[model samples]
Target chain A: MTLSIVKNATCTFCGCVCDDIELHAEGEKIVKTKGACSLGESWFKHHTAERLYPDALIDGKPATVDHAVEAAANYLYDANMPLVYGLSNITCEAQREAVFLAEIIGGVIDSHTSL
Target chain B: MIYWGGNPAECHPRHFTKYSLTQKGKFIPNGRKDRTMVLVDIRETPSAKAADLFLQIRPGKDFEVITALRAIIKDQPVNPKSVAETGLTVEQLQDLVKQMKAARFGIIFFGMGLSMTRGKHMNSAGVLMLAAEMNAFTKFVAMPMRGHGNVTGSDMVMRWSTGYPFGVNLCRGYPRFNPGEYSTVDLLVRGDNDAALILGADPGATMPQPGIDHLARIPTIVLDPKVTHTSRISRVHITTAATGVSAPGTVYRMDEIPLPLRPALKSPYPTDEEVIRRIREAVAKKPAWRPSPNGQMAIV
Candidate 1:
């Protein structure tokens, strides 16, 4: 297998958000990570392109992505006071989307900082 | 440099080597040799080994300690007996104030130990106030040691979008700010919210018992890369690509500096941004929930 190297890959494991790590990937997995601490190394190595779980789940049962999305939307729309929480581990793009969703659904939006 | 209520040695392993202590900066030529490190916490963690001076304070006394320091810096009279209750004497506080005033540059990095304790925000406020007052003697600043990835980014995004950082409410069609009322933990524990959409965090594992029970009672939706603790209990769990690993986007440092993520491998799942946008689009397709223009409040 050919090894592919990516330089200056960012690690979002902690608040430091170290961005100088070097990632070495083989096929679907990250084999080695240089310049990253132990936490960051495990973060990079833990995630792989391989499918580990079902795409979506509804009420502990396997369901299609479309069905799950609709179910989620229906729940949020039907509720009087819905909440959108937990933006700690995701990216800024997703956070923006979450804020918009909260606004449209007339809900409260909070992050881990409040905890 | 002062590390207050934080264990950087174990929590942020590279903080000493990468950012604060050992780095040779323009002002400090000798790096570690020229700088003095102080640590203040309830217990002696591994980080105490790295500090030149360690002060083990009594738990729940952060506010009192910080206030005492503030008084000492301003030359205000403080009762020695009262100071002793904080697990540090007035003499020790005087010496610390001396060192702080003598330094050319000073910084205080406070962590969750100060923020999540009994006094909570008041403790943080005392630290910030102390740092601001220290500027009268030297260049001193204080920063919180934020936890989790992109938490800072979420604060930034929410600030620019809604005019508030966190604990924002838009139920009235405009942004309203109230922490104890709108914050997730308080809302969940009080059973105020009827439904929830949780992303990027596992509150089921970390929240208080009442909050966890409320989440279980509500229709909770989770979006994450794996089937996490929250996912198992949620009504809908959507698998998404992991940020900074298989999904590319932006993350912010604790200092609020933005950094771009470069993925090394392709993932089979959609990104959180895509999933949220799809959910929003689906919600938009439903009938509008907007108030009539006659009852609409104007944005002043």
Candidate 2:
């Protein structure tokens, strides 16, 4: 497999968010990483492009993504007090969406900091 | 430099080499040799080996120790017997105060060990007070050693959008701040919430038994690249692309500096942002929960 090299790749394993890593990827797997600590190396190599799990699951059973999203929305809308938690390990863009979701649902939004 | 209640050697492996201690900077030409490192923890961790001095204090004594240090720094009288309860002698505190006063520049980097203990926010306030008091003698600052990727980003985003950092309640059509009441663990343990949408974190593995049980009891939804502990019990689980791995976006450093993420591979899964947007779109089709300035729900 031909290797695709990405320079200045950021590692989001921890709070450091070291952004000078040089990642060498063979297909979907990261084969080598430079300037990343051991923890970061493992984080970069952990995920792959393989579809190992179902796209979505409802009540521990495989379900379509559309079906799962609708179920999640209904539960949140039906609840008297819903919660949107855990912004850690995610992108800032997603975090923004979570805040908006919490507001529309009239719920509480918290992060790992509150723990 | 003071590392209090944090083990950067293991938790943040590149912290010492990349940001502090051993980094060769224009101000400190000799790097590690020119700087003094003082570590304060309940036990000697691997990071202690790198410290010039390691002060082991009794567990849950951070507030007491900090109070004693504040008094000592100001030359206020503190009972030696009471000071001993913190596992450090008055003489040691005095010496530490002297060093802090004489230093050209100093910084205290505290971690969860101080913030999540008995006193919780009070302990963090104590450290901040100590740092602020030290400024009378020299240039000093204190910063928290934030854990988890983009946690600081979350804080920053919440602050800019809601005027508060964490534990924000928008139930009243406006943001409200209250830690013990609105915080995750407290709400979960108290069973205050009926539903939860969890992302990026595994509270099922990290929270207390009651919190975990409350999560299982509720209609929980989770989004992650893999099936996590929380996902197992959640009512719905969606496999989102891993951030900084196959999902390109932005994340913040511990110091609140934002950086772009360059992904190296393409994943089959949708990004968390995409999935969340889809959910929001789905929810919009339903009836309005409350009247707002916009006929449709505001995105902000």
Candidate 3:
């Protein structure tokens, strides 16, 4: 088995965000991790593109993301109560959506930090 | 020279080994040997074992200890008994103050042990005050050991956008800072919220039990690259490419150092930015102004 080494991969598990991890991948699987702590090691070694469900769900029914989002917008638009939470773990760009959605719908917004 | 609260050995193991504790410095070429190490905590941590001095204080007594230290640094006589409430001796406090005053450069790194406990704000202020006082005699600095890959980045962004960081309210087209009233926990537990649009966060696992339970009962939309606990509970989940892994992006460390992410493989999933942009576009669609049944111009 040939190991393909990839260096300078950042571990997003914790606040440290250690960027020195080197992944040794055998085919599509990460075979080993170097220059990383246990947390970093486990994350880089196990983190993958596995999806829990392929189709986006609107009330448990399969639908495209756009369709689901449309449904979500309708629900939120009609609702008297709405909250926009999370957004801390995501990219800065994605967070803008939560903020925008909350403002448009006259809802409250908060992140994981409130925990 | 002093590590208060945080366990670098666990929270920031790489940082401890690579930068703070063992790394060689220009002023101190001998690395660990040339510098003094002090660990202060409520319990023994791996970092304490490596420190030259370990001052295990009573929990919630950080404010007292910090105040006492500041008093000593300012040439004021500190009441040993009062300071000892933190489980340290007058002699130890004196020695610590003396060492800090004598050092060419002194530094303190504190964590949630001080910030998250009772008197958190006071404790933080005490440490900074102590560091500032020590500057009169020697160079001293203090900082918190941050968590999350881009928490600092988030703070930086928040500051740039608003005058504050975290718990910022922009409902009025203006930013407002109020931690308790507008914070996530308060908003959720108080039942002031009904729906949530979760992006890159997991309050399900981290929030208080009440907050978590309430979140599960609400209309939550989770946007992540992986199937996290929050995503599983979300009514609408959109999987995106993982930042710093399948997607090339920039991440910030605890100290706000930006690092470039090297993508190991290209992801088939959409990037977070794209999905969010699409959602925004969808929500922004509004009916144009139209005449009502009576021919009066009214928005529909």
Candidate 4:
């Protein structure tokens, strides 16, 4: 069994930053991954199926991605008093973008900070 | 010192295996065996069960118990009769103080149990003060057992994004951080915000009763990998790939150490960044509909 090093993969499953993980693949399939915690292992091993997509939903029915985005936009942009929250578990890039959205809408942004 | 609030066993499963407690110190060779573990808590927690001696203080009496110990450490008189309130005798506290003062190296860890209770930041402030005082006689340090995978990361992001830390306000076209003024609970309570976007956090599980009530009234959008109570009730429930597994990102540890997360699974779904990007683009442009004075959107 040969081990191949995978870099820049962020294990989002837990807090521990175990970076140097090896994904042993056999042709397109990742047969095994080494050097991750139990939570990390489970997060990586079991994510085989595609779950919910980021497309917006209107009354539990799938709406076009553009339509969903537009609806969300309308919700925030139309409101004179809006609050943009929840960016703690996203990438630094996403967080920055969310902040920009908040700024453009003249809205209040909050995270999970207990105040 | 196991002497305080941090319960790693319950929250951070690998804390003992990774950090100061079980990890070998430069001076202490034998790991946990060489160190004296003292647990000070209201009830017998899983971590406390492992302590060498458990000083069970009455609930909400941490400040009193700690203050008495601080007095004893300073060679001041602690009323023997008053010590009864702490559930531990004065002699026991004195003995613990003596050991703390004489220890080669000691560390105190706190948890949300302290930060979330009546004391809030003051409890952590007290713990930090205690460690500072201990430095006078012995080498001691303190740490908070922050939960959530990227909570510390979130804290660092907010601190750097805005000059101030959490509870930031962007109301006046500038970032003004006043905890009660800009906090989620306060904002929700006053019925100030018309819309909300929750990312990665499940406030339904974590918030207080009033705060939860406030959330139910707002137009909430939740983004997460799994279906949570918040996601179930959210006006817009957008599910994305997990950051470290399906998606890749960086996170910060409790010690403010930035680390990269490896993507273990290939996600066919849009990243949180993509979701936010699209939303920003849409919102930045003018909305198609306008709201009437009564708060209903009048379709043109």
User: Can you tell me which runs of candidate 3 are displaced by over 4 Å?
Assistant: A1-4, A72-88, A92-115, B287-300
Error of 1 at B42 (Å): 0.7
DockQ of each: 0.81, 0.78, 0.48, 0.46
lDDT of 2 by residue, B125-209 (tens): 8999999999988999998898898999999989998999999988777899998899999999999999999988899999999
**Over 4 Å off, model 4:** A1-14, A18-49, A52-54, A113-115, B76-82, B136-139, B286-300
Stretches of candidate 1 exceeding 4 Å from the true structure? B290-300
Worst 10 residues of 2 chain B by lDDT: B291-300
Candidate 1 TM-score over all chains jointly: 0.96
Full-model lDDT for every candidate: 0.92, 0.91, 0.72, 0.70
What are the per-residue Cα lDDT tens digits for candidate 4 across B173-292? 578877667778777777777777788778777777776676677677766776667765666777677776667667776677888766545666677888888888876566444446
**Model 2, DockQ value?**
0.78
Q: Which pairs of residues collide in candidate 1?
A: none
Question: TM-scores for all candidates?
Answer: 0.96, 0.96, 0.86, 0.82
Docking class of 4: acceptable
lDDT (10s digit) by residue, model 3, range A34-93: 888887777665656555456466655567877876867765665444666655555565
* Comparison by lDDT, 2 against 4, better one: 2
Fill in the DockQ of model 3.
0.48
Global local distance difference test of model 2: 0.91
Task: Candidate 2: list runs displaced more than 4 Å.
Answer: B291-300
